[model samples]
Target: MNDINREFVSHDEALARAEAGVAKLAATRNDRWYPKFHIASNGGWINDPNGLCYYRGRWHVYYQLHPYSTQWGSCHWGHVSSDDMITWKREPIAFAPSLEADRDGVFSGSAVTGDDGRLWVFYTGHRWANGVDDADDNLEVQCAAVSDDGVHFEKLGVIIDNPKGFRHFRDPKVWKQDGMWYMVFGMSTADARGEVLLYSSENMRIWHFEQVLFRHPNPGVYMLECPDFFPVTDKDGNEKWVIGFSAMGSKPSGFMNRNANNAGYMIGTWEPGGQFTPETEFRLWDCGHNFYAPQSFNTVAGDTDDNTDGRQIMYGWYSPFVQPIPLDDEGWCGQLTLPREVFLGEDGDIHTVPAAEMAGLREDSTDLGVVEVKSGTETVVAENAEAMEIEMTIDLKNTTADRAGIKVHATPDGSYTYVAYDDQIGGIVLDRQANAFGDRGYRVAPLTADELAADQLTLRIYVDRGSVEVYVNDGHQTMSSYSYAADGPRAVKLVAESGDLTVASLTLHNLKSIGLE
Candidate 1:
């Protein structure tokens, strides 16, 4: 095949070239910072979880990929499948820039099992005008593709053209409700207001525009990308609708929305042909440095093991955009956060916990039961701390310490990443400043005075080769980030800043790597 990097290539040729590129890179690549238990690209670059669905007795996750290099370029769809969401098997490059509509890129989209026993994918087809790759000089249209075997797909051409009064339009998320198909697209008004446009389709091909479902109240939110609308049952068994989107150029407040882009959701109500009425304000999904463009998956009817429990699972891209990732030099970049089971809480907030399937990854367990520290840090686990799961509970009602929590991925030198509860901030903080190769900053998940007075702060943390995911207080709050630490003895430490602190219980489990290498 001719070089696919040339100005033009056929669809088949693009897929062949991508396979050859992955083969070439796998022969001579060795990277230490790659994730052990996350869904990452085999080579090149990946971002934005797309086309998430359960089909043919397995879970499928498609993502935005650029297989030619470790930097962003013309996008393709990378594929992976798993019986459980934890152990993944890489598939072939699913979609390339094949047709005129998507000649430049096959952007982000969603998937569903059609009524005819086929998997249907709806996505944005992006093309550059006159070979200029500027934002204002491009074409974006909604398109669809179908797969009979759940592997290979055939394009069905453009489904929705670019509408007027919108400068930026992309990331189509489709679903079925009330025996009819509905789709939501993230768009920006000509005057720079972020909006989500709703549409209805009868056959999942022809779509008619409905009203704007939800609009950003703030003028600073320039664009909303990858909008997902779905319903989740609260603790009281009442179904509530949720609308999630990634906001670009969003105004920063406190430690939230401090990145170049952030993912958030709103709880609201919506009908088939009416606008969304939000009952709560916008809330951030994960307060971390490297999270964006999260998508959710609920099993459709006639699928094997139909998810009748109303469980909604989500995965977010665990890396930020336009930043210098340390792993980019190793011929691959990016990972997806662990699959999280999301639900509505009694307090009317969206709550996410690591899915129950993650427990299958635990191996040798070490119980460091009930360790206490006074006015300083103490070593909890002296070694074998690089990849493990930690479960701990701190007695907040009985402790008088100003700050106390656990630190992981630490070296003998004064370098470590920590998750601590600070009395001054009245929140839990995840700090990665001391040992990070890039992207250094901390995130705070605020807590109320009533919560602190209730007596305990429970934490479940997962530390991988170059990343960490922290779930606090039974998923009341979560923080995830990438931290490339210096080489030394991997140790775990517990800290108490000013006074005595008591730990009710603590246990550490050495986790098994999925062996992506």
Candidate 2:
């Protein structure tokens, strides 16, 4: 591979070789993936994880590269390769938005290994043919790039041409079945409805539109983005199709108090020639707010298991709609949700439980069972630990605090979240303590004030060396973030402004990354 963006220069010598355009992002401070050697500088904007496929004895990942600017300008395909999907090696620029068909930028898509062993990437080609560079010309088309070796790709011209109908369709996910290939692209239709365009390809080349796999039932409102279909098997020893997509829309109330972006899954059977038996219904892929744009690679590639769910894992961009910080200084913006193990759980829902690989990063462990705190009381820090989760249940009967609950990563003096049951305000308040970025992140996402008025708080919070996630009441409510190092900790602090409370129980755990050395 050659340095395609030679004109672009970076401050760091090691990062300079990356062919990346932006400076190192101090976006994350702690263990948020600043390897002494590896090259993802820091912060800016990173979207769609493109060209995700299990190839060359490793999982090769290509993404829309905005390594230079943060606002989605002139994207090149950034490269990263990983054998175990944990530690990633940054590769050189694979492809950019140079072709006339993709002047606006090369959009999100998938990579598939052709029957001939060559890797063929099917992606959305964004262009403005009218010679106008305005935002209105962002038309969508399908294009391909083939790689004899998984690292480098060559433009293969347009494959599936854009036809008339919907204006909002894009992001094609391609895969093979019995020597032939198929693609599912998301789009908006003439009827103002969202649909997934299904297309077929022979010899991994010339294409044909098969049929409309799915539509957003509702018109004009629900535009689908990032449609992916993978094969899974049920306990009855039957093969099923898991077609999933993100419903791009505004935030709703309740759990919908989220910023923006959400994903869902449908697990039914696909008969290629016949119709797809849609799963009983669609369910949220991740109830959490940050997860979006999930792509999978068949870990057990080519296995003939009747129960086909291998490590069909997923990775998503954790998007916080109202960012606490700006992107101008930090050249990068987002981080991927720790890879998750995806499969149909007992309840017939696509269970996206965290990957077991994360357990390996555990450094130390502790537990506090049934802590008791009088009004205005807090615990002193115990022995230090790293990469952990603190699980606890509280009974705040007759409590008077306008605030109360466990304080995560609580420093000696600051940086904590006061999860409180406020009788005065009548809601749950996530009072975040002041930190390096200041205390701007504190905001209240209302909870069920009626159901839980009984004075009970059960919280399960995970504090990784670099990231933090709070899963309230067994995943019903969750908050996630990449906390800086100086600010990351495994300490526990409990407080209530008005009265005494009993900590029903507490358990601390050491966490780690799986399949990683």
Query: Best lDDT goes to which candidate?
Result: 1
lDDT of 2: 0.61
Off by over 4 Å in 2: 1-20, 23-43, 129-134, 220-222, 235-239, 250-253, 277-282, 302-309, 367-405, 411-413, 418-461, 464-467, 470-491, 494-517
- Predicted candidate 1 versus true structure: per-residue lDDT over 1-517, tens digit per residue: 0222233557788899887876666565555767788888888788999999888877889999988887888899999988776677888899998787788899999999998989999999887866667655667788889997667998777888887724578999988878889899998888898999999988897799888888899998978999999988777787789999999888788877877888999998877777788998888898878888999977653375744345688999986553567776777888899889888877668889998889988988988788888787575664747678899898887777888888888877777888888888888889987874777778898876666777888889998878889888878788888877667767888888887778889999888776565
The C-alpha local distance difference test score for the whole of candidate 1 amounts to 0.83
Candidate 2 to truth, TM:
0.76
The residue-by-residue lDDT of candidate 2 on 403-422, one tens digit each, is 66765555555654445555
Q: Tell me, by TM-score, which candidate is best.
A: 1
The residue-level lDDT of candidate 2 at 195 comes to 74
